[model samples]
Target: MPALQTINVSKSYGNFKALDKVSIEVGKQSIFGLLGPNGAGKTTLLRIINMISVMDEGKVLLNGKPVKQSDIRNIGYLPEERGLYKKMKVGEQAIYLARLKGLGKQEAIKGLKEWFEKFDITSWWNKKVEELSKGMQQKIQFIATVLHQPDLLIFDEPFSGFDPINVNLLKDEILKLREKGATIIFSTHNMASVEELCDHIALIDNSKTILSGEINEVKQRFKDNVFEVSYRSLSPLSLPAGHFEQVETQQQNGVFVSKIRLLNGNKPNDLLQQL
Candidate 1:
C-alpha cells in the first residue's frame, strides 16, 4: 500500500487557485521528490497533507485509510520557512516540539540528545536559537523534526541554508531515515538533489502536476535518442549514412569522442556496428 496519497486535492484562496486537482502517491519507505517553481502550489499541497490547511476537494489517505487528526502523530514536517523560537534554547525548543508530537519528556530528551550529538550540535543545547548561524539553526530544526521517529517525514527545502558538507550530511541522514522504514516527501527546487535522493518524483507547474513517475522511468521517457561514444582509433572514424547524425566529434588523448543522434529508430548498437 502507498504510504500516503492525495487524491485530486484542490485548494483555493479568493480568486487564486493554489492547487487544482493535485494528486500524488508516495511509496512506503521511499523518498519522493515534490518539485516545482515558486508559487506553484507545492507547499499548499504539503499543508493539506499536514492538515495545516484544508482542501476544497478530494481526500488524503495514509496506509490505505482516510487520514484522521491522530494521524498527525505519524508525520514529521519541516517547513520551508524556519519556525524556531529565537529566544528559546535549542534543546528546550526541540524537546517542546517533540512533546507536541506525543513524545514524553524523558523520551524527547534522550532522542534529541542522540540527534544533537549526531549533528555535532550537542554544545548548542543551552544556547538560544538567535545565537546560532542560519546553518546551525537549520541543523537544530532538522533534529527536532526527526526526534520523534515518525513514519512519514515531509521536508520542504531542507538544505536551503547548509554548505556543501552539511548538505551531504543531510542527504545521508535522509537516506538513513528511509532505510529505517520512514517514508519521506522531499520538496526542493534543486534538481541535482532530486536526481541523487528521490526514488520517485512529481513536478508541479502552475498548481498542477505536469510530470511524475519513478525517477529512472521518468528520465527514460524524456530521452532524446542522443548518445555519446568514446573509443580509441588510429584512423578517422566513419559511420553508415542514415543510421545516425553526428552532432560533434573530437580527439583527446588519442581517443575519438563523438556525440550522435539516432535516426529512423536505429539503436546505439546499430551505430556501433557501423563504426
Candidate 2:
C-alpha cells in the first residue's frame, strides 16, 4: 500500500478552483516530485495534506485508510515560506517545535544537538534566529521538521536560500531519509532537481495534472528520439543525409561532437557505420 494517497481531491476558493480532482499515490521510501508552474495548485494540494486547508471534494488516505486528524503526527512539513521566531534562540525554537510534534524534552534536545552538529551549526544554537543567515535558518527549520522522524515528509522548495554546496548537502540528507524508510513529497520548480531525485512525479498545470508517472517513463515519453555522439575526424565535415536531422554540431580539440534528432528510419549505428 502507498504511504500516502490522494483520491479525486479537489479544492476551490469561491469560483476559482485551486485543485481539480487530483489523485496521486506516494509510495513508502520513495521520493515523489510534485512539479508545476506558479498557481498550478501544488501549494493547495500540499496544504490539504498538511491539514492547513480542507479539501472540498474527495478523500486523502494514509496507509490505505482515510486520513485521520490525529494521523498528522506521522507527517512533517516544511513550507516554501520559512517560519521561525526571530527573537528566539535557535536551539530553544527547535526544541519547542519538536515538542509540538510530540517529541519529549530530552528527545528533542538530543535530536537537535545531533542535527546541529551534523550540519556544522553547533555554535549557532545559542544565537537568535535573526542572527543566522537565511541558509542557516533553513537548516534549523529542516532539523526541527525532521527531529521527530516522521514517516512522511513534505518539502516545498527546500533548496531555496541554499548555495550549491548546501543544496547538495540537503539532497543527500533527503536521500538518506528515504533510505531510512521515510516517504518524501518534494514540490519544486527546479526541473533539474526533479530529474535527479524523483522516482515518480506528477506535473500540475492549471490546477490539474498534465503528466504523472515514473520519472524514467515520463522522460522516455517526452524523448524526441535524439542521440549525441563524439568522434575523431581527419577533416571537418558534416553528414549529408536528409533523414539525419542534426540538431547541433561542434568541433573541439580536433574531435567532432554532434547532437542529432532522428526523423524517419535513421539510426545512430547507421550513422556510425557511415563514419
Candidate 3:
C-alpha cells in the first residue's frame, strides 16, 4: 500500500472552494511533490493531511487504514508560515515541541542538542527565539519538525529564508530522511527543486489535480516532438513544407542547425530518412 492516500478529499470556505475532490497517492520512501500556484488549494490540502483542519468531505488513509486523529503523532509538518514563541529560548522551545510529539523531556533534550550541533546553532541554544535571525529561526523550526523521527514528513516550502548553501544542506537531509524509510510529502514552488528531488508529483490548479505521475514520465508526455538537427546537406537545407515545422534556427560554427517539430505524428526516423 502507498504510505499516504487521500480519497477525493475536499474542503471549502463559504463561497471560496479551496479544494475540490483532490486525491493523491504517495509512495513510501519517495518524495511526492505537491505543486501549484497561489490559491491552488495546496495549503488547504496540507492542513488536512496534518490534521490541523478537517476536510469537509472524503477521508485520508495511511497505509490503507483510515487515518485517525491520534495519527498526528506519526507525521511531522513544517508549514509555510513561520510560528515561534519570541520570548522563549530557542533550545527550550524546540524541546517543548519535541515533547509534544511524544518524546520524553530528556530524550527531547538529547535530540535537540544533536540537531542543534548539526545545524551549527548550538551557540544559540539559550538565546531567545526573538533574538535569532529569520533564517536561524527557520532552521530551528526545521530541526524541531523532524526530531521526533515520525513516519511521514511534510515540508511546505521548507527552504524559505535559506541561502543556496543551506538549501543544499537541507535537500541532502531530506533525501537522507527518505533513505531512513520516511515518506515525504514535499510542497514547493521551485520547479528546479521539484525536478531535482521529487520522484512523483501532482500539480493542482483551480482546486483540482491537472497533472500527476512519475517526474520523467510527465515530462516525456508533455514534450513537443521537436528535435535539433545539424546536418551537412550538399545544398542549402530545405524540406517540403508541412513535412517539418522549423521551431527554431541558428548557425553554429558555419553549420546549419535547426530545431524542427515532426508534423502529423511523424517520428524522428521519418525526418532522418528525408535528411
Candidate 4:
C-alpha cells in the first residue's frame, strides 16, 4: 500500500487556483520527488499535506486511512522558508520543536544529541541561532525536524543555502532515512538531484499535474535511443553502415569516441563485425 495518497485534491485562494485536481501516490520508504516551476502550486500542495492549509476539494490518505489532525505527529516537515528563532539557543529550539512533534522531553533531548553528534554539530548546541551561519542554522533545523523520527518526511528546497559538500552530505542522510523506513517527499527545483535520488516523481505545471510516474520509466519514455561508444584506435577508420543512422566521431584522451543513433533497430554487433 502507498504511504500517502491524494485523490483529486485541489486548492484555491480567492479567485486564484493554486492546485487543480492533483493526485499522486507515494510508495512506502520511497523518495518521491515533487517538481515544478515557480508559481506552479507545489508549495500549495505541500501546505495541504502538512495541514497548514485546507484543500478546497478532494481528500488525502495516509497509510490507507483518511488524514487527521493527530496525523501531523507522524510527519516531519522542513519548509522552504527557514523558521528558526534567532534569539533562541540551538539546543533549546530543537528540543521545543521536537516536543511539538509529540516527543517527550527526555526522548527529544537524547535524540537531538545523537543527531547533533552524527552531523558534527554538537558544539553549536548552546550558541544562539543568530550566531550561526545560514548553513549551520539549516543543520539545526534539519536536526529538529528528524529528531522525533516521524514516519513521513517532507523537505522543500532542502539543499538551499548549502555548499556542494553539505548538499551531498544531506543527500546521503536523506537516503539513509529512506533505508531506515521513512517515506520522503522531496520538493525542489534541482532536476539533477531528482535524477539522482528520486524513485518516482510528479511534475506540476501551471497548477496542474503535467507528469507523474516511476523515475526510470519516465526517463525511458523520454529516451531518444542514443548511445555513445568509445574504443581505442591509432588511425582514423571508415564507419560501418549497420551501427547507426548517423554517427558522430571524435578523438578524446587518445581514444576514438563515437555517438551512434541506430537505424531500424540495427545492432551494435553488426557494426563491430565490419570494423
Clashing pairs in 1: none
Q: What is the Å distance of residue 88 in model 2 from its true position? A: 0.8
Clashing pairs in 4: none
Q: RMSD to the native, candidate 1?
A: 2.8
lDDT of 3 by residue, 1-275 (tens): 99999989989999898999999999989899999887799989999988889999998999999888889999999999878999998888998899889999999999888888887778999999999889888888889889999999999988878898989989888889889999998887776765789999999999998889999999899999999998765444677788889888777556778899888878889998878
Candidate 3, which segments miss by more than 4 Å at Cα? Answer: 227-240, 248-259, 264-275
By TM-score, who's the top model here?
A: 2
Clashing pairs in 3: none
Worst 10 residues of 2 by lDDT: 234-243
TM-score of each: 0.89, 0.90, 0.88, 0.86
Deviating ranges (above 4 Å) for candidate 1: 228-241, 246-259, 272-275
Residue-pair clashes, model 1? 0
Residue 211, model 4: Cα distance from true site in angstroms: 2.0
**Candidate 2 regions off by >4 Å?**
228-242, 247-259
Q: Highest lDDT, which number? A: 1
RMSD of 3: 3.0
- lDDT (Cα, tens digit) per residue for candidate 1, span 162-263: 899999999899899899999999998777865789999999989999999999999999998988888898865677668788888999888988888999
TM-score of 4: 0.86
Clashing pairs in 2: none
lDDT of 1: 0.90
lDDT of 3: 0.89
